[model samples]
Target: MGCARWARRAAPARDIYLTYNWKWNVDEEICGICQQGFDQMCPKCVHPIECKPCVGECKHTFHVHCLDQWLLKRNICPMCRVNWVIFRKFE
Candidate 1:
């Protein structure tokens, strides 16, 4: 089976929750966006941001403000060039 099909089949049963051990106090060392090592701020805007890893299907995580600016120029994801779908709900 193809990777995408495999991912789709497995996704429904997978738990997406992220858990951390607060006993070690490691939150300060992790990046909120990519959930990896500490990321540096953008020099142009002075906003902290994490760069997505090169290998992945959905490596499009970014700061809301920074990504908004980026999306203005292109509709596809910066890292993967995959078209993004926007959904807005009215409450």
Candidate 2:
């Protein structure tokens, strides 16, 4: 029973670890507005928000500043135009 419970707990942790640690590549996660890698800043902005926002469905990422600016005019993903505002993951 203890082993089974540990396995259940470990599975999600492993999945999350692999999902982020294994699959995450800085080269691929470029900010659309700035065209910079994850480690870089948005060109139009001076200060950088540590956790960037990603649209969950299409997996497009952006700086919070850029996304918020876009949201002011339109409530959609800049890349896919998929009615964004919700379903976004920041970090």
Candidate 3:
């Protein structure tokens, strides 16, 4: 029936909206890198890329390129010096 088809379509739209809201909320609170609340930045680097959260526990979000370069020099977090290897294991 027409009603059944409309209901099916509406269900998916509602689900998509709910998912978007949840993702938005999570991204706002958690850092993409450290997976923790927003923290400080690396002193050596400047101009982070749009403030995306770090994907680790240090929760110290930073610019992608800045953190990438820093990691090349050291395997530990700049803030807490937590081993990158340990962080990877958790992921």
Candidate 4:
């Protein structure tokens, strides 16, 4: 009779490395245009604007549409006279 040999295989565990870059700015809870708290919908369109964009220079939050309307008349931030300078890192 011939003897049979069996071999066992083991799986190796892999380690994953992840890196992330996050940029966050503090935003007020109320929309200046609507005068409504973030928990409420935009007063103009009656839509949610949570996490809505804010003026980087002043940290003021506003509904996108609302800001658009305001921007039509002026190029500066509504709350601040600061020119709307889009942020970018020059190389």
Candidate 5:
């Protein structure tokens, strides 16, 4: 066949490696309460999903678990010390 020669020279991939890098779209790179990166798993959380980034009305960012625990002690944001109001939780 006309294409046989080229096909025979093609090298087969013995191994494949893949990776990706992603970050939350927030102003803060680290959680105020936990002091951990928004991309990192919260210390109190067992799964990555539970450590999702959360934003407050004051525009501060925190890990979900970190914020949740901080809220239990006081009703104010850990960063700004403002009234803690959940603006949104990013999944």
Candidate 6:
């Protein structure tokens, strides 16, 4: 709807920068589906040491495992009800 803004500042490593930027727009620091912090291991994490987060086209974020489980039942995002596509993925 409007011009997209790109930050002029040099970015941190991608995973760090993207995750940190999301914090400002988020009301809660938890994944909408699993109710766990993005960096914490939710019950849904397939591997204990690696809980990647995925950002959808709607800009809502979720633990990848949680979102995968969700996508199995419905294609829309649990937070925004937008058609969920993996727009950006972070490790």
- Predicted structure with the largest TM-score when compared to the true one: 5
Regarding TM-score, does 4 or 5 come out ahead? Answer: 5
* lDDT (Cα, 0-100) at 34 in candidate 2: 64
User: Top lDDT: which candidate number?
Assistant: 5
TM-score of each: 0.33, 0.53, 0.36, 0.51, 0.78, 0.63
Per residue, candidate 3 scores C-alpha lDDT tens digits across 1-91 of 8887667434443433332211222223434344343333334334232333344465444434455776899887666788753222211
CA lDDT of each prediction against the hidden true structure? 0.42, 0.63, 0.45, 0.57, 0.82, 0.73
Model 2 lDDT per residue over 1-91, tens place: 7787667434443433432222224334777866776666666656445546565356677777777788899887788878775546555
Error of 1 at 88 (Å): 13
Superposed model 3: Cα runs more than 4 Å off: 1-53, 85-91
Off by over 4 Å in 2: 1-27, 44-51
- Give the residue spans of candidate 4 off by over 4 A: 1-26, 49-51, 86-91
Candidate 6 colliding pairs? none
Give per-residue CA lDDT, model 1, range 8-73, as digits (tens): 434456568985432211223433333443344433445232332121135334434445666688
Which RMSD does model 1 reach against the true structure?
Answer: 20.2
TM-score of candidate 1 relative to the true fold = 0.33
| Clash counts for all predictions | 0, 0, 11, 0, 0, 0
Least lDDT summed over 10 consecutive residues: which range in candidate 4?
Answer: 82-91
Worst 10 residues of 6 by lDDT: 18-27
Candidate order by lDDT, decreasing, is: 5, 6, 2, 4, 3, 1
lDDT winner between 3 and 5, please give it: 5
